[model samples]
Target: MSAIMSGAISMGILAWIWANLSAAVGVSTWAGFMGTTTYYASGERFIKGWVKGMIANMVGVLWAIICVEVSKVLHVPNIVAIMTGVISFGIVAEAKWKNLSFVPGVYIGCSTTFGMLALNGTYLSTVVALLMGSVVGLLSDAGGELLVRLTNKKETEENLVEKQG
Candidate 1:
């Protein structure tokens, strides 16, 4: 399906950019862009979904970075790196449980955020962003449900008319 294909394309694009683009800007921009694009395919829409998509990815990425940066500073062996990676993966899995945009953002942002977090340590900001992203996804799923109900009802009504006619 297009959803699978889009996910693939998003990953491919991320890889390519990582290889070629500047560390700070590219990661943030592409993660947000791809997250937004991929998030909508489930037919969900929130009043502020776009903002949610951006913040979720940006925050999720930063969270992953926190673990990596701390590990480097504390030099607590490679355990930090391993832990952060696992945590980031886990967060992504949680978000993806319903095919929400948060999953992609968290996955993509964490890898990028690791470096950013190393340099800046904006943990609070990242947390806030992730929360926003979660809200966006929640709204989108709710919206999708409403849309499905409306469409189905309309179809049933049309069929009833045809039958009666």
Candidate 2:
């Protein structure tokens, strides 16, 4: 239930921010932010999960940028992309972000990274947008949690009063 609410909130925030924030940036790059936020909202603890997810997002974004740049520079075809993927796999396999952060940074990293490539977005812009959205998502989640807890507390207090009366 909380997860659903969190996801909804994250999406809603993204939608609201899309017009002003994303327009100023690029939609493609902003989408990476949305993607990471979605993953964060759906997963575990907001702060902790977001931290890990951001780490993964950064890694992925960096890798994708490198891949795209190198691909363009060398005029290499599909092979370079494959090699990058392999390298990503090797890093994740070795580091195991899931255990360390309680979140799958590897998946987030790769998805965000590849997303940037697919959308033909700039690296710095994508990273900025992603990080911005991530911060918004985290705040939204925190705010949502606070509202729910306050509501629950009020309800509980009301129940207690009724029983006493």
Candidate 3:
């Protein structure tokens, strides 16, 4: 499991982040996917990791419900539900790539889809959602590895010195 934040804790953070994000953007899907990725990446035992992931998502869904309730009060008329779901799913996809190369585009597409479409096509939203999910998983995995390097805090002046390209 990854370390910057422990597995369950990371899930909570992911949930919190996603919930807030969805509330702000009128979507809640991407939050749990990203949380699950962290659950896998975090340093828990394999079975424990899966359990944490499931539980974390259970809590996240509850949070989503809360967001839904709030939206009723705010009267924002969320057209972006699909976008939130897609981007939330994107969190799982980004887990595999730390550099997040595809993330920005996916986020835009996912976010826009929710904003604009009422009943989005399976052909388009589903495809984009899956692609975005994969992207997020990739990025999350890469991000963990990168954080490891960053936190090692190794080296001295020589390490900082630039090498010839």
Best by lDDT: 2
lDDT of 3 by residue, 7-92 (tens): 34444554566556545644335533543443454344444543443343333333334444555566555634643564467545
- Model 2, 1-165: lDDT tens digits are 354675577557655775576676555535546645644644766777677667666766665666666677785568686767766665566565454332345556555666665666566656666777777667667766776677678889999999999
Instruction: Report the Cα lDDT for candidate 2.
Output: 0.63
lDDT for each candidate structure = 0.52, 0.63, 0.43
- Pairs that collide, model 2: none
The full ranking of all candidates by lDDT, starting with the best, is: 2, 1, 3
RMSD of each predicted structure: 9.5, 3.8, 14.8
Off by over 4 Å in 1: 1-121
lDDT of 3: 0.43
Candidate 3, superposed: residue stretches over 4 Å from native:
1-121, 155-165
Q: State residue 146's C-alpha deviation in candidate 1, in Å.
A: 0.9
Best by TM-score: 2
TM-score ranking of the models: 2, 1, 3
